[model samples]
Target: MTRVVELVEHAPAVGVALPDAVGRALAAGDIVDAVPDPYVPGHWSLRAGSKVGAVAVATPGNDEPITVRVTPKVPITRLFFLLGYNLDPKGGWRDGEVDVTGHRDLLPALAHAVERQVDRALRQGLLQGYQRREETSLVVRGRIREADQIRRRFGATLPVEVEYDEFTTDIAENRLLRAAVERLLRLPGVPHDVRRRLLHQRARLVDVAVIVRGHPLPVWQSSRLNSRYQHALHLARVVLENASVEHAPGALRVDGFLFDMNKLFEDFVTVALREACRSFGHSARLQDPHHLDEASAIRMKPDLVLYGPSSAPCAVVDAKYKAEKREGFPDADLYQMLAYCTALGLREGHLVYAKGNAPHAAHRVRHAGIVIHQHALDLDQEPSGLLSEVDRVAAQLVNTPRV
Candidate 1:
C-alpha cells in the first residue's frame, strides 16, 4: 500500500507506516521523525522537519508514487515579499517573471515557473556562450592526447583522447537549472503532464557538473539578460539543495520539505544590514571567524560583525528565530554576544529576533561595561516595514563612537 502525506512546515504526518523500504532513506537525514502522536494515544505520527520536497515511495501493489508536499505555514504574501527583497534587492531579478502569489505549493510552483522562464530565455537564445574545456577522444580533432593515444589505441578513430575547451550551450548555470528542474519532476505534487514537459525541456540542455551546488553563482554572469538565468539558478538551488529527496528499493520519498523561516529571516536581515552599513560609511563582516580560546584553536563564528571606519570591531549582532520570551535562551545569546564585545573591546552587542508579544527588551550586566539589546523584527508587517526595522537596527549598532 502507498500513502500520500501532506504537512505544513515543521508539522507532523501521523500514523503512516511508510513501508519498510523507506525506513533507511528517512534515517539518512530526510528530516522526519516517528514519534508518539499527542492527539492519538498508543499510535505514532511521522513528524516532519524544516524542508520541502516530494517523497516517492514504491508500493508492491501499484506503480503510483507516494508523495509528501510540505507547505509554508506563514502567509504566502509575506514570504513572497521577503524573498523578493532578498533576491531582487532592486526589483531586477523578478522583472518579467510570473507572479508567485496564490500558488498552492510554493516549491513546485517556483520550479515550474522557473522552467517557463528558462524556456522563454532559451527561445530567445542562450546568453554569454563561451568556450568550455571538455575532455574527449577523437581521431581528427583540434588537439591530441598523447597519453591516451599510447594507452587506449583501440584501433578506432575515437582513440586519440583530447582535452580542450569548446564553445557550447552547455554551461554550469544551465546544468544547475536542468538538475533542479529534473529533481522537481519527481515531485508527485507537480502535475504529471507538467513533469513530462519539464523533462523534455531539461533534455535540451546537456548535463554538466552541478558545481554551483553549494556556492553562489559567479559574479561575472550578472547582466540584464542573465536576470532570468540568475533567478532560475536560485530557484533551482532551492529545489536541489533546500529540498530533500530520499529513495530505496520499494520506496522513493521526498518527505523532507521544510524551509526554516527563522534562518531566512536572519539571513535577509544580515545581508541587508551589510549593504546598509556600506551606505552608513562603515564596513561589515558576515560570519566572521575569530578564535575564542587562548590556544587560538577554538573558533567563534558570529552572524554579523560590524567594523568601524578605523578597521576595529564596532559591534556584533546575532539573529534569533524567536523572541527571548518564547525562545527562553536570551542568556545564552548574551554570553556569546559578551564574548564578541569583549574580544572587540566594545561595550555592547545586539540581538535581533522575530516579533513576539514581548518583542523589544534589553539587558545590562551589573558592575560591567557589557550591555545587550534585543530587538524584534515584525515579520507580520510589510517587507518595506521590516526593512525599515533593519535600518533602525543598523543605526543602533553604529551610532556611537568607536563603533
Candidate 2:
C-alpha cells in the first residue's frame, strides 16, 4: 500500500518525515517546495504553491510508493471548466460533454474524460487519409527519385528511391489519440475501469504509430473531413503538454500531472474577454508584445491588447491571479500597466484578477494621465456567470474614449 500526503494549495507548510530520496526528487521536480526542517530531524516541510495535482515518487528501500497530492483551491469541476474553455471556446467542452461528477482527483477525472471522448471519436471506425511516404524499394512505385537513384545506386537499377502517397488509417489524428492513451496507461492512480477502457481504445488504434517520447507530436489540420476529431485532439493536447515525467538518480522516478492556476486564470481571462468583445468589430491579441523604450531593447508583453478598426491599439489589459488573497493590487502590476499605456499611447488600461479581498478599484498615475482599472473575476461561479463578468469587463474596455 502507498502512503499519501495531502496538501491544499496556498496552505501553510507542514512537516512530514519524507525519505531523503523522495525529498530530493520532489525538490528537483519543482511541483512543490520541500525543505529540510531545521528544528525537526528527519522531517521536511512541504508547501504547495499555485500548482495543484498529484506527484508520486518511489523510495529506494521501501516497496510502497509515496504520493503527494495537492488539491486546488477551486473545485475540480470549475477547474475543468476553465481548462475546457481554454482548450476550445467554440463547443470543445460543454457542461454535459465530459462528465467529471464523481471524480475526487484531477488525474482520474481527466483520464476518464479523455477515454470517453476518444471512444466517441472512433465509433465511426478509424479515419483513413493519405500519408506521404518516401522509401527505397526494389520495384518502381509512384515516382523514382532521379538524383538519388543516380547518386546512390550508380550503374545499379535494382532498388529505387521513390516517393508516393499511401492511403491508410495511421494518420496524425489517430496517432495523437494513441499517444494520450499510452501516457495515461503509464501514469499511476488511474481507476481500474478507466484504465481498462483506455486499453480498449488503444487496441482500436493498434494500426496507428506510437509517438516517440520527446519528439514533436504529429500535426493535423482542422477540416470538414477531420471535424469529428477536433474535440478529442484538443483534450489530448492538454494531457501531452501539461503532464511531467522525470527520472531521478538512484532508480527514483517521479510522475506528475499538475496545473498552474495562475496560468489557467490568465488564459481564461484573455481568451474569454477576446471572445466576449469580438462582436464589437474590433480584434484582440493575447500576449501582445510591445517595446517599452525608444532603443527597441526593452520588451514587454501584455496579456491582452485590443485594437480598433484602424489597427491602432485601443486598450491594454493584464491578467493577475492572486494566490495570497492580499488586500490591495500589487503596485508592480499598476506600474507595468502604466508602462503599457504609455508605450501603446492609450489613456486607460485594465488589470483583471481572480476574485481577491480587494474589490474593483481604479488608480490614476500622478505624473501621467493614465488610469488603470482593476477588475475581479469570481471563479467559484457557474460558467455563464464567469463569462458574464468577462463581458462586463469587455464593455468597459471597448467604451474607453480614444485619444
Candidate 3:
C-alpha cells in the first residue's frame, strides 16, 4: 500500500462526528455500530458497516487541535476530515473537508501520515516513561585528588590510597544506560554482523557492568568501527536514567541485574502493535490480566491481548525473544496457545519472534472444532517494512472468510 499522511482539526466536543466524514470521504462500507472510549469522557467512535477497520481519538492537549488521521483498508482518492468546532458551550458542530492540496490524494496518504504521527506520539510516550525511570538519582561520590598520582599509586600498588572526602559528598547522577542499550538493539540499518558481534560481546559486557555499577555506566570509546552501536547505547543509557527501574524501591543489587528479556520483548511487541493499529486507521487497547483456562489446571498469561475495530477482538499476539527460533514449532507453545485460544474462544493467534527466521508457513490446527491459525512475525525486518507486513496481515484477517 502507498503511504498516507493526514492532518485535521476538530472540537473536543464534536470530535465524535468526524467518523461520519471519514466514512463518507473514504466510502468505507457500512456503519457497524460505533464504540466510545470507556476511558476518555468525550471521544469519537465509528465502525464501518463492512467491518473494514477502526479509528481512535487521541486525548487533546491544552487548547491543542483535536484531529484524527484515517488510513483505510482499501486505497481511496481523497482524504476526508470531519472537523468539529465548538459553536457553543453546551454542544459543538462538525463539518467535513477534503484536502486537494499539491497533487496529494488526502485519504490514503493522510491515513498513513496520521498513523505515523500517532505512532511517533505513542513511541514518545513510551520513551518518556523510560525516560522518567532513567532520570533516577544515583548516589555518586567523587574526590578531587591528583589523577596522575592516584593512577600511579594504583598502578604500582595492590592496595591504593583510599580517602573519604567530606567536601565531595555523594552526588546523585542521572544516567540512562539501559535505555541506550535497548535503543541500540532496536535501531535499524545496523549491519547484522555488527549487531551480532555487539550482542554477543559489547552488549553482554555492558549488561554485566550495569549490574556491577548499580547505576548507568559511562561509555568511553573512540573507535569508529562500532560507532552506531556505541551511539545507540549512549542514548539508551540516557533513557535509563529516567526510567522507573533506576529508582527501584530497594538498594540495587547484583542479583537484580538479571534483565527481563520477556518484558523487553513484550514492550517491543506493544510498540509494534500500536504502530500497526495506527496505520489501519484504528487504535489498539491492551487487555491486561488476560484470563486463560486449560484442562491441566495450569493457567497461562500471554504477553498481550489487543482489541481493534469497535470492541471486536482483533488479534492475540505473543512475543518470544530467544537466541534463535527452535526447530519446528515447540510443542509446549502450541499446547499452551491452544488452551488460550479455546478459553478466549479465538480462532487464531500469533507468535512474534525477535530473531529473523525462515518465514514459517501459516498453520491450521483443530481442537474441539476450533481452528487456530498460527503465524510468526520477523523482528529482523526494517521498521517500516515490518509495520507494512503487519498491516497486510491485519487486512487479510479482516477480509478473509472465517471457517
Candidate 4:
C-alpha cells in the first residue's frame, strides 16, 4: 500500500512526517519545497507552488511508497480546457471531449483522457506513412551513399550504405501516442481500468519504436492524412514534455507528471487573445521580443503584442497566472508593463490575471503618461464566458490609438 499525502496549490504549508530520504527527494524535486520543521522532530513542512501533480518516492526498507499529490487551484476541467486550447486552438479540444469527472486527481484524469483520445485516433487502425531510413544493408536498395562506401566500408561491394523512404505504420504519430501511453502507465495513481486501456493502446502500437529518452522526438507534420491524429498527438506531447522520472542512490526513485499553472495561464491568455485579435483584423505576436533600454542590453518578451495594418506594434499585454497583491495587481507587474509600453512606444498596456482581488484597475505612470490596465479573468466560468472576456480585452486593444 502507498501512503497518500495531499496538498493544495498556494495554500498554507502542511507538516507531515516522512522518511528522511523521501523528504530530501521532495525538496530537490522542484515541484514542491519541503522544509524540515525545526521544532518538530521527524517532521517536514511541505508547500506547493504553481506546479501540480502527483509525485511518488520509494525508500529502501519501507514496505509502502509515499505519494505526494498537489491539487491545482484551478478546477481540473478548466485547467484541461486551457491546456487543450493552447495545444490546438483551431480544432484540438471541445467542451465534454475529455471527461474528467471520473477521476479525483490530475494523474488519473490525464491518463484516462490520453487513453480515450488515443483510442479515438486509432479507431480507423494505425496510420501508415513514409519514414526516411539510413542504414547499411547487404542488398542494394534505394539510393546508395558513395561517400560512406569509400570512408567506412572502404569500397566494400557486398554491404552498401543506402537511404530510402519506407512506408510503415511506425510513423511519428503512432510513436507519440505509444510514448504517452507508456508514460502514463509508469506514473503513480492511475486507475486500474485506465491502465488496462492504456496497455491495450500500447498493444495497438507494438510496431512503433519507443522514442529514445532524452532525445528530441521525431517530428511529424499536420496534413489531411493525419488530421484524425492531431488531437491525440497534441495530448501525447503534453504527457511526454511535462512528466519526468528521477533515480537516486540507495535504490530510491522519484517520478511524476506536473503542469505549471503559470505557463498554462500565459499560453492560454496569449493564444486566446491572438484568436480574438484576428477576428478584428488585427494580428498578434506571442512572446514578442524587444529591448527595454536604449542600448538594447535589457531584453524583454511581452506575452502578446498586437500589430496594426502598418505593421507597427500598437498594443502590448502580459498574462499573470495570479495577482501578487491581495488588494490589486502587484506594483512590480505594473512597473514591468510600464517598461514594455515605454520601450515599444505604446501609450497603454494590459496585464491579464487568472484572478485577483479587483476585477480591473488602471495606473498612469506620473512621468511617462503610459497607462497600464490590469484585468482579472475568472477561470471557473464557462469556456464561452471566459473567451468573451478575452474578446473584450481584444476590443480594448483595437480601440487603443496606434503607437
Q: Is candidate 1 or candidate 2 better by TM-score?
A: 2
lDDT score, candidate 3, position 362: 56
- TM-scores vs. true structure, each candidate: 0.80, 0.95, 0.35, 0.95
Residues 1-403, model 3: lDDT tens digits: 1111232211122225333333232222222234555666545454322112122222223232222232222122211111111111112111122222322322222223222222222232222111111111123224223464366555553333333333211111112333333333432223344355435433333422233335445444434533323323322332343222221112211000112324444555555565556656555544344556445455556665556566655555565544232565655566665666666667776666543322444556743554444445554444456556666655544432223
Off by over 4 Å in 4: 249-251, 325-330, 357-359
lDDT by residue for model 2 (122-196), tens:
999999999999999989999998899999999589899999999999899999999999988887778899999
**With candidate 4 superimposed using the best TM-score fit, by how many Å does residue 149's alpha carbon deviate from the native?**
2.2
- The regions of model 1 sitting more than 4 angstroms off are 1-6, 10-33, 37-42, 46-67, 88-96, 127-139, 150-159, 192-200, 203-228, 249-256, 323-330, 400-403
The 10-residue segment of model 4 with minimum total lDDT is 322-331
lDDT string, candidate 4, 111-230, tens digits: 988988999999999999988899999998999989988898886796899989999998989989998898898899999999999999999999899997888987899999999899
lDDT of 3 at 184: 36
Question: Can you write out model 1's per-residue Cα lDDT over 37-77, one digit (the tens) per residue?
Answer: 45655454676654544455555556655555566655655
Write the number of the candidate with greater TM-score, choosing between 1 and 3: 1
- lDDT per prediction? 0.65, 0.87, 0.37, 0.87
Ordered from best to worst lDDT, the candidate numbers read 4, 2, 1, 3
Runs in model 3 with CA error above 4 Å? Answer: 1-266, 285-287, 294-299, 322-330, 354-358, 378-381, 396-403
